[model samples]
Target chain A: MNLAQPIYARVKDHILAQIRSGALVAGSRVPSENELVSQFSISRMTANRALRELTADGFLSRVPGVGTFVREATPRTSLIELRNIADEIASRGHHYSSRIEDLREMMATPNLIDDFELRATTPLYHIAIVHEENGMPVQFEDRYVNPFCAPNFLKQDFSHQTPTAYLLSLLPAEELEHNVEAILPDANQQRRLKISSSEPCLSLHRRTWSGGHVVTSATLIYPASRYALYSRTSLGKQTS
Target chain B: MNLAQPIYARVKDHILAQIRSGALVAGSRVPSENELVSQFSISRMTANRALRELTADGFLSRVPGVGTFVREATPRTSLIELRNIADEIASRGHHYSSRIEDLREMMATPNLIDDFELRATTPLYHIAIVHEENGMPVQFEDRYVNPFCAPNFLKQDFSHQTPTAYLLSLLPAEELEHNVEAILPDANQQRRLKISSSEPCLSLHRRTWSGGHVVTSATLIYPASRYALYSRTSLGKQTS
Candidate 1:
């Protein structure tokens, strides 16, 4: 018992230590404020504050008219990050490999005008690569790049480095946007990913910008069973 | 032309006008830097800079040996904002409705011990709701609440307000987390959402925290064809 600390804090710490030490397990009733005042020779307000603070902190739960009990532990807050697929697999201690299916410089079409903001006949490089982890096909990537951003895109040796890695090395994305959809794989996607038609796939379309220019627009499809996305956002400043 | 501005900016604005006015149509070639230098009596470097900056801003594309042509318009930068579902529907000018499938108090299970970090016997409030737009089922919501956070969760009249609205009114989430996956709905989910088994669904699991305590954990399921998620993230400060 640190005498320098406030009386309420000392009481809270004592209860916390008991809970941490497994003496007060989850859902087990905690000492009532009256019981705490009698046991510790403290005022009712001091005992009440300790329990109230603990309840608000998730260390305990208060059932009105019933009793306060130890709360269950909650999940830790997640960290949301946008990372390259190859690096993601590597960090998992798995080998990353890719097979390039197609690479070409094609004229942009009308529909692509919306995605790339380029006129038709504008030369854009398109590439398709199947990313594998531990010999299993996990993602199929289809991408279109503005040739002005990566003039040597089609000529790069992708077997040694992924396109995402190459792009990041040259022009790092200053802005990123994602449109996610739940999809049933098309026959071509199923064949490339080796998935059944019934299996749902996560299709993530990502666009990156660098130096105020659209760098790349890419679609990566992953089998849902193999991958899930986690994102954490701060809402502390929002009012409505 | 504004003579006070740099000569290069004047030339760039001239070309931008033609492009924006439909005189220089999409895929049409722009005057070469040499032509611009001679035509405007400007320095070659100035002409070069004007074209280079235009290309970088997605106004034109240079096809190496070919020539610089107007580029397609790219999608505008997206703003990522989190919003409530009922509000989202109302903003679309659609009538929002809901059916409360089940609302009860239950004991936490061993598996949920990881999610809520509570003992198995910890009491939690559970609710299942089917959300409709114009009488068509669109989403199935299942949620578990910490009784300490919302003791009246099961007693609320969901017909007038969503559980999300009720919770947000009492406790504003300081931190929000999401786990998104593509899935085929189980029989119960399918029946509740009134969807075919073959249809794909987007499953979004969300958890919110307020005052350092977990407020609620919810799973929202939407049909893939009917819903998609958009998120924009800033990557300016990231190095790796």
Candidate 2:
């Protein structure tokens, strides 16, 4: 904020402006350090600092042997962080709702027998729910539950309460794994979500465990245009 | 694999296998709980456990007023944790190399004057580099440096060392900030990265600073098909 501040920041803002204004298009190279010194009439040290900082911030790319160049701007892409969809939507001032489609108990099939390493006649509970945001369908929640993990799940009314909330109340989890991706929506999804065939959808596959048993698994689908993922990283366990 | 194990895992796997084997096509509703219980001749508890776990795993959807339905399978996407890009490619058994494109010193522009709060004529350095994996172009790095933070950067032989490695050697950082995103590849990027127009690209915009002075800023780009972003989250932080 004063004269004592380094020249690097001064130069970085200048370059960043050019980028924001499209004057410095993607892949375009800026002047070299020597050129910068002569152009700005500044010391070589100052010019070097500016470029070095810019390279580390990811606005420019420096190849050891080649030269510096402008990096392309990517939009709507961020480190995918784990977040509750309901929280995300509600924060934006939207009404969030879920309609439970079905809930029942049944016998495990042969494949289930193998996957859960269960006996031929193990029992499980299955539930399907449609999640809506602002009266528009956003995700279809297809979930499988370990009854032993949350015994009273069937008695709870999901229309006013989310399974995530209920399950957390019944059992606290120690570990969680989540996977997400983009894919084409199927016909039923298209109809339920009221999205067209041309639109791609984002899907999240999640598995959560507690007490060394698989507590729950869920597939959550979202209309691609409706959601974007966000995440941040630090050197250690810091979160922002 | 035994009776003592939970029934949920087995049922979830059974549904997944059915979907994978095309026994249950997309958009098809799965059998109701009563049907499953009768078919497997298992207790309602066992059937419920299977369905519940499968739903959580994203294999099925249940609508309370409607019925239980088979959900489309979405690819399981995972976030690529934030780390040194060089380290990432190296982990995949590849040689990574970077070419220094340009290096020079210059005066700060009007924007730089404001952002870095510098005098109108402060000096700065600009550097550019391109990173490659096994000779295949991957990331184009453009960077700006703050010379005041690392005065001897100009004298460093970047060809023999990475800017990150060199800078870290000169000054140890105590704090950092990062931003990442995805965007369509531009013409220059398409040519430099040898990616086609149809291919989307992932880009990262990062900024790191120490001691309240902006140290570095950079932008990194990668082809969409070649990479995906990932991250992990824990509940302890939120509760604590």
Each prediction's number of clashing residue pairs: 13, 127
Q: Name model 2 segments beyond 4 Å from true.
A: A1-82, A98-132, A136-147, A151-156, A178-206, A218-226, A232-240, B1-82, B99-130, B140-160, B167-182, B231-240
lDDT, residue B127, candidate 1: 91
Please provide, for model 1 over A1-240, each residue's C-alpha lDDT reduced to its tens digit, 9 standing for 90 to 100: 556999888999899888766788778999999999999999998898799778856688887789899886532212234467787676344678989999999888887777886655688899999999878999999999989999998889999889988998888678887888899999999999999999998888989888878899999898887887766654423346
Q: For this target, which candidate reaches the highest lDDT against the unseen true structure?
A: 1
DockQ per candidate? 0.27, 0.04
In order, candidate lDDTs are 0.80, 0.65
lDDT of 2 by residue, A152-206 (tens): 7888888877887778776665556655544557898888788876565655666
lDDT of 2 by residue, B11-53 (tens): 5556665765578876898887787788777777778767765
TM-score of 2: 0.51
Whole-model lDDT, model 1: 0.80
B49-110 in candidate 1: lDDT tens per residue? 78976775567888877878986543222223446678889999999999998899988887
Candidate 1, residue A30: Cα displacement in angstroms equals 32
By summed lDDT, the worst window of 10 consecutive residues in model 1 chain A runs over: A73-82
